[model samples]
Target: MKFKIPDRRRLLIAASLLLSSAAHADDAARAQAAVTDLGTQLRSALMARVKAEGPVAAINFCHDQAPTIAADVAQKHGLRIGRTGLRTRSPGNAPADWQRVVLADFETQAQAGSAPQTLRYSSSEGLPEGIALRYMQGIATEAPCLACHGQTLAEPVALAIKAHYPEDAATGFREGQLRGAFWVEVSSGN
Candidate 1:
């Protein structure tokens, strides 16, 4: 049978679909790149703090810096930014919106005996129309980190941690265990 010519309406619909998909892909890529850049800066700042002060200081610095850096990057890119720490127990069965990408990377790095430096992507479960990106780095199990994040918190560090976070659960870490995960979330409106 002879093939019929395509109509204008059908051609337009196909073109629209192609463009929408391409736009989504582009948005995801751009969001990833923005987060990567911000993460690099945050890492550099945290490392500097660690070198200047100590691991506890670095953790404190990161705690303050992560959100600021993420917000700045998101604002610059005209996107929303958010982050969450991975839990010891997978929240897969929990009602809360758990971030699995960061947790997986942290677990992989913990098993490999290396600091995690990978950034992964995922989409929101509640808002499936958006894209999410995350990055995890090993918090060096140094003496300072052990103070608060260590199995036995040092007096001074413990006091400081208590003062800052009275109900903190980010502790009881070993010298080489994954202390916690750092994350960045971006919505692509896809």
Candidate 2:
């Protein structure tokens, strides 16, 4: 089918929109990578510790080393990064308002058969308290994850968790269910 050539103004506006969209997409990809990389490093560390030491050591790593890893990654990436869950073990893992919305959407999507690794999130604004580019991906519970985040824990595991996190609520998750999300953010002006 033959089509009329677009007018100059219309063509300019279309180009602008396309470019904006592409830029946002690029930013989203970068954000996803940062969060994924950080999570990967932390998970590997925890898994190695679990295999070598045990659940108690893994729990301690989650309580200690994990935060250090997150902070280091955030510093390296120059972004705000963290993990949050609906039922959090550490108070630091509490979801912000925007994170709550994203987590709820993740739950709904997961219930409808969306795999956690396939979940994607990106927004240039709408952060809970500030303007930022936000990305979050759900974390599904896996076999290794169960050593610390399982539905039922061994007595020693429970004691270790209690000793570390007195108000832990980040358990009772079944394998393949959403354990939480890894999120990354940067100021919109960045």
Candidate 3:
């Protein structure tokens, strides 16, 4: 048996493809880490705030500090991470066009009997800087979230939410329902 020797150009192309695949995998892993860290930290901090002060105070924390915490976690993971939904409490948290499509898909999956927490989406897209890895993990509404996001909010909680987000639409969630998602975008050069 004789084996043909590959040309140098073919070998180079194969090597480049291999490297690109490896980079894509690395980006996905990093984005996953960022999502987990950001979600855990945000939930813990919001719970602590609600316990110490009340749900109203938790609203303030979400309004003022959640973005900062997300930024820190994204930096720690060398990516960009945040929260978004079909209905956002903060206008700034509204989903982008791609994210809206993902969120709607998540909701459809959930309605079709898939658990909300099991829903996730990821993709790669071209950007001016290069390729970007985008990931989103579903956030299921829990008992604690009811205080602020449930169908009926306490008067103070409602007022607090209104004060912070005049156009809030993130309420009306029930336990086990889809709340939103933690989204991450990983790009070249962090």
Q: Compute each candidate's TM-score over C-alphas.
A: 0.60, 0.88, 0.89
Candidate 1 vs candidate 3: the TM-score winner is 3
Overall local distance difference test of candidate 3: 0.86
Off by over 4 Å in 2: 1-12, 125-130
Off by over 4 Å in 3: 1-10, 125-129
* Best model number under TM-score: 3
Model 2 lDDT per residue over 1-190, tens place: 9886779978999999898787678778778878878988987898798889988988887887888899999888778899998899999889998889999999999989988767877887445565457888899888878867888899999999999889999888888898889888876656
User: Can you rank all candidates by lDDT, best first?
Assistant: 3, 2, 1
Tens-digit per-residue lDDT, 10-94, candidate 3: 8999999898788778888888888888888988998899899989878888888999998899778877788999999988899
Write down the TM-score for model 3.
0.89
* Superposition error at 97 for model 3 (Å): 0.8
Model 1 lDDT tens row, 1-190? 9876579878998999898667656666666666567657766887788789976676577656666777788788666544344433122212124445556666676678675334344443344445443223333445544555667766776776666566566667666665544444455543
What are the Cα lDDT values of the candidates? 0.57, 0.85, 0.86
